[model samples]
Target: MINVNEVVETNEMIEKENLDVRTITLGISLLDCISSDLEQLNKNIYNKIYEAAKDLVATGEQISREFGIPIVNKRISVTPIALIGGAACRTKEDFASIAQTLDKVAKAVGVNFIGGYSALVSKGMTPADKLLIESIPLALSTTDVVCSSINVGSTKTGINMDAVRLMGTIVKETAEATKENDSLGCAKLVVFCNAPDDNPFMAGAFHGVTEADKIINVGVSGPGVVKTALEKVRGESFEILCETIKKTAFKVTRVGQLVAREASERLGVPFGIIDLSLAPTPAIGDSVADILHEIGVEHAGAPGTTAALALLNDQVKKGGVMASSYVGGLSGAFIPVSEDQGMINAVEAGALTLEKLEAMTCVCSVGLDMIAIPGDTRDTTIAGIIADEMAIGMINQKTTAVRLIPVIGKGVGETVEFGGLLGYAPIMPVNQFSCDAFVDRGGRIPAPVHSFKN
Candidate 1:
């Protein structure tokens, strides 16, 4: 039972701070909707998602109003289309049709985004995986509300350089395809390694085949709540600071647990998990980088940033695990430059660099997210970056992703405005050094020896 003090505190978090449920994602598996006929397959896919998610937006609004908790976005994630659509979608155009169907259903159902236009080739690519990878640029550019992802590596199997190389070109094509919108399509495509099965976030979220036929996963956001709490404990010892973060995270996760259970019950679906990620927003108060600053770092890219982030990420999980039993998904701090004002400021001030961000992802939940690079950046260079991040996840046995946007026609020092949640950012310059030879070696990087844990 939530006490009056708890309720009052939660209300304060919502009112004063930027506390809110970041997303209520309905995970709908599309394996059962597969067919050999393209048109039939699309029909089945549309009906399945539209029917399953029909009540999603309304239910989210109802929960927000009744509970006084703001549910920011209602979204959906389907099974990897490459697994099921290969039988029907033979060409890139066919895959675009499926993307169109997804976009149409998402709009019809009133959801903000529908994920799972994805392929998973951690070790090697199948014919289907290749098709999906090749179709990513066309599919994402031709549709709205449809997001895509590809997982090219895992701890169990090393990085697939073939897929990595291909995706670099695909990402460039996506930028070119959506150049009219400031390369917004690149924002909707994420390349991940060790991608979680139950992530409730967009672009990277997908209803893994291992998941239930249908489930509800909620991502809780409260960077402002955490930042506000830390303000009081400023200049305190690390022990005191960790305690403050733990307690704050505990309260935040509690709200998420309640919302997840309520949503599951009302939607008549099983509750998946509460992703207690301190997801930041473009809003002033809701910045994860500010938390780093509060932790005594001058800025997010300062010398102590990585250590500060390490402490924050670990304490968040420690505080969150006790608050809910079904804790899954990437449950830590996300440092998306476009979405976090502090991060944007750090970058603009030249305090943060791409290399610094790479090191930071080593300890954080995700890696180098929402970064905009110069348009003419080499595809080989992009592949090299993805390979490095994948190596981190593979070695650390944790999830790491790269959501890089090569803003077409934009170079360093120029800001691209992707209004709303996809905030504007100064295009960060990349190393002009060539990695063509390294990326050109199209072979798999072998798994680590420690993978023999079984």
Candidate 2:
């Protein structure tokens, strides 16, 4: 089982191809931390997260050093605060106080970000869910490391148009609240359809109520490695090309499997899924768009882009599932505009647009991710966009998320710098056409006929 060539190949991927374990996320459930007393609830939440993740960063670093694999981030995802704070959080501020506690524990444990300042309202919002949803703007604005997400739709439950409409206004408020930082608060917030519980990624990661009390999940990324493999079979037949990608993905995911097992064993936590997403960075060569280009697209949003992405996504799953028994989360290619330089280049070259990106999300892992839009764009328009994406997930029964930054004081044709992993984005124009009447219909979009399978 131990092959010298495979070891050398993995080293090459790491050293030359930007292959790395994207994140080692500790999922800690906050259900037990719930209390009727607000102060006690906050304190209990803080201590639970702190104890669960205190060794996370150090453990990740140790594994990286020992194995010579780069582990990019150590993070945590907790149960939705709405559920945990239901009894104590009477107002939006009360929920925001919970976010502050999350931020404090994240800093104390030394993780990059902590997710699940979230409310799951795929069908309807409860009193607690509504409070947490309303608190997102304040919670994200005040906290440094805490991230928030709202699940507004799911296949089984249908889309909550009310939540979608409110999120549109909430997104705008978040942008205004953090305008000084180029709407960085919005960068940490996401809206999802069919959001996964054990997603080792942010700003969508949350410990689903179904997960164990504590577990370790790892996300691995290697777009450059995939591209490099495809290059070797350039101009080859479709069969050959697909074979190349599958083999390459298998190798890359094996690295994640190793890391996940080691991290779990060391941390004394059960190992969760390995999210083998082709999560690109701002770094050149590490882009899913580049992989698409290697697969025969001139640019990411080109005519055959969606088909190309579907192929890649399918093969990635086919190969990755073989590498580990537990393969979950959004396990495919991520097409975040700001995070991938190739996508950024595509946008600037006018080869990619919001419309094209939305079409692409039908095949990719996530939806309309890390996109910056004009501040003046109406919240109704944003609601309409979210509804459209959610409809895609509902019909297709796949996970799709939106992490849009409506950069305040910015408009189309301008660029906003988010720095680090968020990278920068050229503000893209949105349809000026009004969708107020459509969004004003404040009711749920019933689940599709396929959802009644049982």
- Scanning candidate 1 in windows of ten residues, the lowest lDDT window is 1-10
lDDT of 1 by residue, 12-65 (tens): 999999899999999999999999999999999999998999999999999999
Model 2 gets an lDDT of 0.94
**What TM-score fits each model?**
0.99, 0.99
Tens-digit lDDT string for candidate 2 (1-454): 8799988999999999999999999999999998999999999998898888889999999999999999999999999988999999888899999999999989998999999999999989899999898888899889999999999999999999999999999999999999999999999999999999999999999999999999999999999999999989999999999999999999999999999999999999999999999999999899999999999999999999999999999999999999999999999999999999999999999999999999999999999999999988788899999999999999999999988999989999999999999999999989888989999999999999999988
User: lDDT value for candidate 1?
Assistant: 0.94
Cα miss at 262, model 2 (Å)?
A: 0.5
Error of 2 at 302 (Å): 1.1
TM-score of 1: 0.99
TM-score of 2: 0.99
